[model samples]
Target: MSEKLTLHKYQSDITGLMIEHKAFGVFAEPGTGKTPTSLYVVNHFRQKTLVIAPIRIAYSVWPPETKKWSDFNNIKTGLLHGLDKEQRFLDDSIGIYIINPEGLVWLESMVAKHKRFPFTNLIVDESAKFKSPSSKRFKALKRVIGLFKRRYILAGNPMPNSYMDLWAQIFLLDRGERLGRTISAYRNRFFTRGGFRGYEYFLRPGAEEEIKDLIKDICIFIKATDHLDLPKLVINDIRFDLPKGLRKKYRVMEKQLFWDLDEGKILASSAAVANSKCQQIAQGFLFESLSDKQKYDKVTKKVYDLHNIKIELLEELVDELNGSPLLVGYWFRPDYDKLKKAFPKAVYFADSSKSEAVQIEKDWNAGKIPLLIGNIASISHGLNLQKAGNHVCFYTMVWNYDMYDQFIKRVLRQGNDNDRVFVHRIIANKTMEEAMIMSMQDKSAMSSGFLNAINLYREKIKEYDE
Candidate 1:
């Protein structure tokens, strides 16, 4: 007997809409099953599909999703990345070509010189990455977007930072029919320049509504709350104060924008460099030299570690969680190294080898590997870590609001078996970490206007259903 396929009412609705529209964007929030919904449409149509996604997703997500569900098991899939890319291209056995967004230009180059374009449809995962019209990926993809008989854009938070993110994304779908053909035209219609000597453009009054309405015809917005019967999320803000000496050093770095440490062997002499130095200090450690710092140019001095305050907090969290698996989102290179040393058996998501990474993912999901640690930027957009565990710890916060918003969904999203997930933010009190969190929150608020529109549509649907 064939396997049964069951999807929620909203999932069925969006899948139906995709088949009807042929080309559209799905601003479905995380845990809403955008992957399965898109796959269903592709299965029904049986067209050769091109999926453009971030490197992590393109490598680990799409192929796994296809394999997990028997519903789409027969559809052939190939990954266009790394050394085996040419083989994947020539396989002729696969119907789906998944490529990283960064490689779109190279794909264009391939088609222009020696290859033929084969995909009849395009699915741009993490469409927000192409929010900028001037980006090389978007420009390259635009030249051939019309070649696809169908196209779909997927993003959990579609407009992560600003409404400006909407223009290029919408353009790829409707060919600038909904938004203006040119970015400048779109900007002039809804924004006015006002910030910093008229260099920045802020949205004019009611511009959000106008922009929302323009794209509503071809876009579907699905909220996780309305669709998924999900577990509760528990968030803990664990804040700590720096030691007296460390506090003084941080103050010097922040105020004077310079610091002399280790007998002039290490120095932070500029505002940007000082910012990195101070943030590192807040985390209970600092590289011995500015040259070894990632945020700025490296100095020639040897790197040194100052403390392990946050590491101590992580140790406490580990003890508190007992023996359960935990997913830790470490933000810095040093943090990853330190975390691996502290949690010896922990599995890290890395770029060691493609097959090994796949095996690591399988091991994690199968409950064999506990304490999985990954950089937030590396694992943000895609990859299903929900099965591993429900506790997600942010050892360090990130600057981009979207990454913070997306990273949590790994465990909080649909298919998670746990009853409730815990999200921990180990914050440094009175430091840049606090400032970074606040800045992200403020920027995230910019999406409330779009969410309001989504709420209104849901209400209209609820009334009709009643």
Candidate 2:
């Protein structure tokens, strides 16, 4: 008898889902086997799969990950990147074709004119990138969606701020199937007039039920934490207390801007103190007034206070593991600067060619740079850094949950000695950090829209069941 294929319950659920929904959505949390689950869906379809992911993810994630499972070495794969037409064609002719979303800017016009490609399926990995209707990438994706017979969008964080994100991804799968005849119809049905610049704007008004009903048939949503027999994923929140002096200053600024509602008065009240606070928070030393035309002058000296605190926190954990490499996720320029300066040899930078990024990845894999500092834009979605660091530290939070979730998943993946995936967020007390985290939890519910997408899935499933 053939060897029995083993799968986790959620993985099996996804495999079953593939038979039904031509376009499906997997909204599981980070570190819950989303990568493998997504690949299983592609493998089952047995088509010329075209995966669009971040460049780094396109280059690294699939190769090593696919190798971990069956002896499917004969399976062909190609990476479509750069501005090379001849190379892309050569690669696309073979197995799975992977391309970056940014590369769509160049290929969009070509695809429009040629209108011919061999792709059987177009998988929008990290579909949140196309959530914005105004983006050039969104237009490019729509133009190319017609070329592929089957379309699938994969994302953990689909809804960023509003239901507006639901429009673009759903359009790619089957336009007019969900929402309504147009994007405007869906917006007007669920939203009511709110506020604008001395004018009225529209907002969602208790429309969760309506939003859920709209996409009921086309999406598959699952949470890893809700499933059984899965390894334990412990999530913790770490809060930091601001110093007494800084707290007093923060309160005064907070009252002026929030309570008193005096923008000019607040600025005038603490001109010196505000500048100093901003500079210090920036991980730079003192703020100095310059004769430049720009309103905000640059920091003059090197401030080691923020670095000292970050290093102290990381070192405490790293020492416990006998100095095992720790992958530090940094986004802001100041965070990157502080991390790079504190550990000069460990920072990863993206170049035009992205060769530096590749080398840093290798060094990290080989455990050369134990303390790796990376930005989400530079290293978030596509790369696998799990071999080097099983532990992750977030200096601050980012607005995009796609980048945030993808970066952490890079470390907490399969084949590591980590007892538990350690994710630490060094959030400053009572700042945007708290609000950003809360927003992330809410925005990730874009996956829940799949419950609304069930009607579409039921149609497809009924056909398959017969």
Candidate 3:
């Protein structure tokens, strides 16, 4: 911790506000240095702090922030994860316990055995992950939250999809005084149920204004673009309809849960698997696993590709990029394999060795890599790839709002002062792609959360069918 940490006015302001409350939240947007700012405030209290963050972030972000600056060194930090890391939990020498959000369920059981919880301060980074009150991790943390003297929550996109996300997150901080004491109480006060199964919830009129005002006292909101001279984030939504033949094939493949093909056929085991094929085909490719491995001397599993329009778009997008590095987020292995073949020099930031990862990061930041292809799950969290280039295109999208939000900020965050980040989404019209895009961007800010977005997406699926 040799370097000094200097906070921007807004960063210091947010920390000051959180410090004033026994329990608080900082809803600062990405690139505003929430890690250091929150840590700076945590350092003042001089007590052990428990940090629960995204798995990748827990592995990379907090521990480095603590070591990079001189003040952070005073706090002993330990990252807890995996069965092999059991020693970290029992080790009393560590003052700051940073654990993956998934690890909380296990930690809860372990710490429950002890007479007292180990840490005094509990900080949830990307607190939006716990927005669902019924989730195992949220319930686990809720059981032990009261044990902490100072509890802080942080997320730039805290309510990424809707203001309703504020409830569970804020509930952990202040016990729902600002939202409601119970999940039902909170939802009932602000939302009216409708849509499919009457389970869909929308905010009552004027709910947004009143809700923000209610929680303003304890939650500090910071928009980085407001405070920093960041280049603009330009999003280009490229919508294309599937070809008539492909569209007909898509409908048939979706309904029958099977595809008749050359030399072999593809079959889906269940409804969920069939639904996934719809998503895959919507993204321009469908994978067919041929069960006839015995034909190849039992050596390899064969796969077939049904269609590919995204690859054509990738070619055009690359030409448009004109040598500027591109970050492509795709969902499946075929997408990865296709992108790798299209751009021979492209680097993938996936499950690579530590040495290979180091070179990938270096080459990307230096602008030597033409394309960096990754799944939304692979290239997110505390990794600073913003220095690479600002041209990011989402070849496909998934359901989680948190992953969608964080993946975009990878190149739009702090170090990207020079480039105007362009986030291009190649969405297939009248398909699940549109539904995924709409749910993520839906302005039902007052009531939408992951569960709400999922319902909204499913409702859109029916609309597409109609």
Candidate 4:
């Protein structure tokens, strides 16, 4: 039998705040029980709610969450995704209709065709995805905002890139009453363009405080550290030097934008492409083609193996763990392939079928899987694996702040049984891997716009003089 649902004091307080405001933003970190707290609000009103989340979360997270807590037993959730979504939409018994952000386009069309919207409340999980005003999902939701009487947005980092991200998300709640009527108005009011080609927007003096004050009534920012007594998180940077021959090749590629391999020439068409290639070399491999075709056409493009230092380091780390479950995050497909080859016992999360993935997750949480490997982009959100492990190793670094943050939270969350969580980062010294880590750290500290963060990252890389 499931245990009785009990809300933490902070959750209860947030619930009250949500109920009182009707339309609000719950900027609570992962594992902070935002889902249950929102469910409590939905149950209190007994209203039909529509939740927008990532596809994985829509299909896996919400329904189980409702069933997990006895307090939410009364809440019925139907996933409106995949081929059977239309059929599922016809079910009137579902109290909460869960759909991915992209599904909003279809939902908007349905509302227009039917000339009515059924949901009384709106809940957007990971609302940061809708931060862009120009995004199709945001536009779709804006068209039907009036259909929902009570609106709420939930996110751990709503402003994942910059404060500019808050405009569209906050617009969904109060229809731009708190921020501005449009993104341009919001930008003009709070920011000035300062970065390269006048593209990056920086906040003006006192704009942060003014903006915070305006949205203070509707937005509640909650940090997990402040509320949850989670275990101590220890981050370890395991640095290694690239092979001398590989090091020379890495510099040539960085300077010339192209490198000649015995098989074919590896090209970096632009700065971004060069950065990606640099990261690949740092991880000990280089792909023949710098095109998207390489991702799919496995037969045509050749992947040259540069070094095995990272794999060797990872094996050592696993040996040190002594058979304990270790969650490993990788970036590129080559990285996953190499990790799997090195540790044959490891299971790749993305390579598994639906049923297999479900079983893998079960085995992982049950402490049955020893080494679970996953692409950070794939498993960054929705799934919970904190029950079985407290140790995470980044086989390769990632540039996206949101993915990196969510990846760590997967293990360091509230349900872990351990008193400490260890995060091991395998970085190549004087390589793009170091630059990527520095970029992530700076972005986390500054919370600047994405492009601006990239520019800052490039400046840091230049200092390396590779």
Which parts of model 3 are misplaced by more than 4 Å?
112-116, 160-164, 236-244, 247-279, 287-304, 319-323, 340-345, 352-363, 366-368, 377-380, 397-402, 427-466
Per-candidate TM-scores read 0.85, 0.75, 0.79, 0.89
Candidate 3: tens digits of C-alpha lDDT, residues 1-466: 2898888888888888878888988888778898998888888887888999876677667776787799888788887876656678778888888888888877877776765567888899989889899999989888888889999998867765555677899899888777889989988999887643464567789998999899888888887778988878788987778888778777776545322311123221122233577787776666665556666644443445655677788889989889988888987787787777777767777656544655676678898988888888777655667887988889877665666777888888887856588999888876656656665775333333333454555565665562
Give the C-alpha lDDT of model 4: 0.82
- In candidate 1, which residue pairs clash? 288-304, 291-298, 291-299
Sort all candidates by lDDT, best to worst. Answer: 4, 1, 3, 2
**Residue lDDT tens for model 2, 1-466:** 2222367877887767766777766655555666677777777777888788877667666654566567334456777775665366555446677778887876665555666466888888878778776788887777667778777777766765456677777787777577665667767776665322222223465677776776767776665456633234455555665566655554454334333212333322223233334324423222334454374465343334432465555556556767677777776565666566666665555322455666777777788876766776566665566676666777656655566776777676554556677777766555434544664565442323222232233333343221
RMSD of 2: 10.7
Q: Residue 287 of model 4: what lDDT?
A: 86
Give lDDT per model, in order.
0.77, 0.61, 0.75, 0.82
RMSD values, in order shown: 9.2, 10.7, 6.6, 4.9
* Alpha-carbon RMSD, candidate 4: 4.9
After superposition, the stretches of candidate 1 with alpha carbons farther than 4 Å from their true spots are: 1-3, 254-275, 287-304, 439-466
- In model 4, residue pairs whose N, Cα or C atoms come closer than 3 Å (at least 3 residues apart or on different chains), thus clashing, are none
Q: Model 1, residue 85: what's the lDDT?
A: 84
lDDT of 4 by residue, 41-158 (tens): 9999999999999887776678878888887888788888777877667778889999999888888777677766679899999998998999998888888888788999999888
Q: Give the deviation of candidate 1 from the true structure as CA RMSD.
A: 9.2
Model 2 is weakest, by summed lDDT over 10 consecutive residues, at 445-454
Across residues 1-466, which tens digit of lDDT does each residue of candidate 1 receive? 4444688999898888899997888998787888888889999999899999888777777887788789989988998888888677667678899999888877887777766887889999989989999989989998998899998999998777678889999998999998799999999999997533455567899999998898888998887878787779888888898887777677666543322321332321122233576677777667764454675555654546777888899999988988688888977677877787887777788544666666776777788866778889777766676777888899988656778877888778887878898888899876666655664555453433323332343333343221
Highest TM-score: give the candidate number: 4
